[model samples]
Target: MTNETFRALVVEEVNEEIQAGVKACTLEDLSAGDTLIKTSYSGINYKDALATIKNGGVIRSYPMIPGVDAVGEVMETTSDSFKKGDKVVITGNGLGVSHTGGFSEIVRIPNEWVVKLPEGLTEKEAATIGTAGITAVESINELERNGLSDKKARILVTGATGGVGSIAIAMLKSLGYENITALSRKKNEDFLYALGATKVISLDEFMPEKIKPLQKQEYDFVLDTIGGKVLSAILPQINYGGAITLCGNASGIKLETTVLPFILRGIKMLGVDSVQLPNEKKEAIWERIANELDKERLSTIGAVEEPIDRIEEIVTHLLEGTHSGRTLIKM
Candidate 1:
């Protein structure tokens, strides 16, 4: 593997503007790390899409690869944790952000950031789950810990068509939860229903005609991926002692609401961050995804496989919000 050049999506600053494209790069170009992996697959995430543009708040430096997720076989290692030919998964921990990421045919990452691929998942399946699925499982685990183990609890998942929301709904259903409502603006009712959402409602139906400090308690638990107004609006509607897991901010980041929901309703808000979570916790969640998640239904969650060279088009689709489900990139 000496002096081998590989194709990778490189984001760089050109004349004070951000530009990204596939380029030929050698092993020497990668940032120093403890392990080197020959990437078999990577996933297109919203954060990865933003890393391609100026002021996207994803990439911290220029001429960096922009994929936060990668799964493949180990080619070389300086650590005792892994060996050559062992399959492993890597995501977040500043990958595709402050360091060289997984948008290339080969990636070199620190040994502490890699997790051995779980037994039940294929490389492609693991990539399909990637960061989004891990976030979903983490959010659900928080809800369970807060007393959502009852299958009859009414659960609401916002941004129900996105990767995390969709996977959360499916996982909840698979876990025996009976009442799951999905909130989305897209007209993909059948798709959401196929993922085990018992009911699908549009924004018009979910949001009240007037924003209020408090509303009638409706949901026992809420999995919120769309932050901003959507989160504020849902807060007032949570039942007493209910819980809400906040993950993504696809809509916006600001929240303008009173403390009525928290002080009066006893509603708990749990924040989820998969990017910087400790490797052990991430591995535990990955194991849960491998053992508990319905693998057969994963393909139905809208994973489109693309080669490494075609990532630019998918990035555009993600930024435009026209893409549905996960986009798996094959190396």
Candidate 2:
């Protein structure tokens, strides 16, 4: 495979600008790693969309491949943990940020970053879950550990139309959670309902004229993907002893809330990060995701499938927030 070439979407600095397009690459062009994978499918993530734009702050280097999660089969390896023909999945761990990523027909990555595809999960299913699914599952896991045990708890998920929030809703429903509310900027009530949201609230309805330090308590648990004012407004409305798992900042990064919720309500706010988790933890969460999640409901999470060539258009839709659910890239 020395002289073999494959197609990849490369982001390079061209005359002080970021230019991304499909280009031919060789195995030699990839970074040295113990495992070489033939990518079957990859997912389009927010970070991957950002990495293509100029000064998006996702990629620190030019000529990078920007796919954060990939599901594929091992084609070659120098690591004892894996051998040729082994199916695997890779996500986070600097996959698309500091290293060459999954937007290619092939990817050579460190063996430590790889996880064997658990039984009962297809390549498309694994790729559909991708990084967004992992984040959603991890956030739920943290909430469960911190006292979100009531299956009938009133749960609210922000950014409901997005990948993480949609999957979170589906997973929660599959886990037997009764009441789930979705907050979205778009009018996709039916879409949210199909994903098991008991009710869908618009941003306008959710945000009032002003947010008080301690508003009426409503939610038992919140899977917050939109931070900034959304998070600020939500902090005061959490029921006493409830928990909130924050994993995204699509709104903004600032928080202007008082500590009354924490002091008086005894609520817990947990931050979930899927990117830097240890490989063993990732494997465990993935195993739970595979074993515990309903396959039919999980299958509904990925809404679109297109060849890798159509990535740029989907990226544009994702960046514009016009797209919903997950988009899979067939390689």
Candidate 3:
């Protein structure tokens, strides 16, 4: 594959200004790694959208490929874990951040970052789940590990239209957990209900007329994707001994709340980070997504496939929060 030129979305800083576009690049331009992958699919994640912006803080260097997730077949390898033509998937571990990522037709990365594509999933199906699905499952697993039971546990998911929130709702329903409530700014009641949400509420309906340090405990568990004021508002209303998984900052990053909820209610706030999770845990989560997640329902997560060249349009939609569900990039 030496001297081979392929199309990749390149992000560079010219005169302290950020610029991103699809360009023809050779194998030599990629960073040094032990394995080479012929990319088949990638996903448009929120972080990937941010990497294209000037001050998004998602890219650590310039002239880098900006995709946090990829699914493909191994083209060459120096490690014993994979061989030529073996299908694999990779997410996080500095991809599109500190190193060259998966926005290219070819991606070269460390063997340690690759996960053997789980059985019972096609390349496109795996890419559809991508990092968002993994993060959503991780949040649920953390809650269960800490003491979230399926029986009679009233769960609330914020930002329910986004990838993580939507997938979490479906997965929770698949596991037989009823009484799921989804909160979204958009009026997509039909979509949310089809994803198994028993109730759908808008932001204006969920937030009270006045802010308080503590309110009536409305939910037994909260899967919060929108941070900032939403998180602050939800904390005080969590049931005693309940837990909240904080996975995203789509609404904002600032948290203005007190300790009364924690001290008096004994509620737990679990922070989840998919980008830096270990490979073993990632593989485990993928296996669960493949085996346990309702395959037919999982396929209905509103994924739309687009070519790599159209990534800019998808990025614009992501920044404006106009799109729902996952966007798969066929590399």
Off by over 4 Å in 3: none
Which residue pairs clash within candidate 2? none
Candidate 3 lDDT by residue in tens digits, 1-331: 6877999999999999998999999988788899999999998888899999998978877888999999999999998987999999999999888889989999999999999998999898888889988999999999998788865699999989888998999999988898999999886998888888999999999888777999999999999998988999999999999999999998899998999999999999999999999999999999999888887667778688899889999999999989898898997
User: 65 in model 3: Cα distance from truth in Å?
Assistant: 0.8
Ranking by TM-score: 3, 1, 2
Q: In what order do the candidates fall by lDDT, top score first? A: 3, 2, 1
How much lDDT does candidate 1 score? Answer: 0.89
Tell me the spans in candidate 2 whose CA falls farther than 4 Å from its real position.
none
TM-score list, all predictions: 0.97, 0.97, 0.98
Worst 10 residues of 1 by lDDT: 295-304
